[model samples]
Target: MPAPTEMPTKHSTPYPTWEQFQQMEKRQDALEKRQDTTDRRLDSGAGEFAEIKKAQDTLRQQQAAHGQTVAEVREILAELRELVESFGNLKGTIRVMRIAGDVIRWGCTLGAAALGLWVAFRSLGGGL
Candidate 1:
């Protein structure tokens, strides 16, 4: 019996022409350009967000200052109210003192006049 002969193997090769290589390069360049544009937009958005955060911080600080100012004003108003109340009490005391002084003065004057009349009656020999 004769031995079987082996079949010959075929080798494969890829051949890319110059025009095809140029087209691929152009496509890659376009893709890179689009990616760069997208990256720039992302960076701009991030910067804008940072600015907004700074503005929010400034607003919070201003609000805190305003709150402190309001508290101070309230304290001042309370003190003023207390002062006014004290002044009113003082005025009432002064009015009461004035009324008492007037009463004492009138009582003393009437007593002196009555004593003088009694002395005159005695000197004229009037009966007790």
Candidate 2:
């Protein structure tokens, strides 16, 4: 009987040669270098992002403090408005008091003059 022939495989080469293996190693090294560069860039970007977040937090705190200060200022303004209104009312009251004082002084002066006239006439015997 004849010896059995070997069956043909799908690919032409069964395994990679020395030069092909060397080329694959070089490609893998390049890929690793690129990955390292990407990792370093991502790390630096993360630090920048953290710094930006911290700054935003500080700004928010400052804004809150300013809001409280504004509220306090508004309260002070309201109190000042009430004080001014009270002063205006006091001015009107003082005017009314001054007018009343003038009227009382005039009434007293007229009464005293009339009494003096009556006494003089009685002493002079002017009545029949």
- TM-score for every candidate vs. truth? 0.57, 0.69
What C-alpha lDDT does candidate 2 achieve relative to the native structure?
Answer: 0.90
Which tens-of-lDDT digit does each residue in 41-101 have in candidate 1?
9999999999999999999999999999999999999999999999999999999999999
Residues 1-128, model 2: lDDT tens digits = 22257554544455767888899999999999999999999999999999999999999999999999999999999999999999999999999999999999898899899888888988999763
What range of 10 consecutive residues in model 1 has the weakest lDDT sum? 6-15
Model 2, residue 78: C-alpha shift (Å): 1.5
Model 2 error, position 95 (Å) = 1.8
Tell me, what's the RMSD of every candidate? 7.6, 5.6
Query: How well does candidate 1 score on lDDT at residue 27?
Result: 96
By how many angstroms RMSD does model 1 differ from the true structure?
A: 7.6
Best by lDDT: 2
Highest TM-score against the true fold, candidate? 2
Global lDDT scores for all candidate models: 0.88, 0.90
Residue-level lDDT for 46 in candidate 1: 96
